[model samples]
Target: MNNADSASQSVQTMYAERFATDLTDNRAEQKELTAQIERLRDRLEQLRTDETWLTGMQAALPGETAPPRPRRAPRTGRKPAETDAPAGTAVPGPRPAGRAKARPSRARTSVKKAVPTAAAPLHQLIRALMPLGEPRLVREVHADLAKAHPERGTSVQVVRNTLETLVKRGVVGKGIQKGTAMYTATAPAASEGDEAPAAG
Candidate 1:
């Protein structure tokens, strides 16, 4: 009877040890699965962020062709001859034989000042009508311009001319509807508030 009792106690102990070992193994597997899940989540987040950045870059650099380079000013120092000057006025005689002609200085004119005729009023009009999603008819534009510049009371012809000029300068786009034309704003106005470049 004493031997049988001792054998039963040893079996119970072995069973408890086996149960403990199985529980420990299960916990280790759970921890490994949790780590793998976290790593996968991190990779998904990284991929989403990368996709967003790629989309922005694609928007910023649309179209296959690169932007055209700005034209450089001519290197010749000669000032344009004053063709409109009256014939009688004593044009300054060429520098005396011994004195060297002074080199013409390069003046850095602000873009706004350079395009004064086209930029200021046009910019004002654009600011007044921002986020212009739809095309505006010539008559409607003229009316808006007149309302904004009541003191000037601009004519339809003038507004049309300005719109055409804006189109040529790439500041505005023209849309045709029913054999008629409409205008739409392009880029933001310049910081110095100049008018858009004039059409030839």
Candidate 2:
């Protein structure tokens, strides 16, 4: 009976040692897996940071690799007052503070019949063609000029060209309204006081 009891106790001790070894191995495996998961998370965060940096760099570039803007032109050798005048047009000088009044409205048929020599200056003709406190088309100016000076023969192209020149000089404002180019005089007629010295 004593021998049998000793044998049984030995067997129980062996089984306990085996169970402890297995539990230790399981704990080691769990630790290794937790480390691998942490590494994967760090890699994902790094990738996100790199992506954000690349996006910012793209935004900094102008128009996404657009060409550089051209330099501004040098000033002309002409005087500041003559600056308002168009090329090839005769500008006597800068206009006086007080300008001459426009001619009274006349019949368009009579104005059209008038000779070129009798025609009013182009700038004066344009002003007379314009209405108070509103924008007018080049065609409207041409029509009005015909009415005001029947003898004068001003073409529609000529009127448009003159208006563009006026816009560059800053006396007139140009803008697109309803998909059409419209122009208005920046200064009021009362301030203009009748005289438009600049020639067409």
Best by TM-score: 2
Best candidate according to lDDT: 2
Worst 10 residues of 1 by lDDT: 64-73
Residue 110 local lDDT, model 1: 31
**Poorly placed runs, candidate 2 (over 4 Å):** 1-119, 189-199
Q: Model 1, 128: alpha-carbon shift in Å? A: 4.4
lDDT by residue (1-200, candidate 2, tens digit) is 89999999999999999999999999988985675466556656644443433333332343432111111111222223323342334332212111211211342243344434354467755765576558887767777776665444555676788888777766678888898888888865444434554547
How high a TM-score does candidate 2 get?
Answer: 0.36
In model 2, how many backbone clashes occur? 14
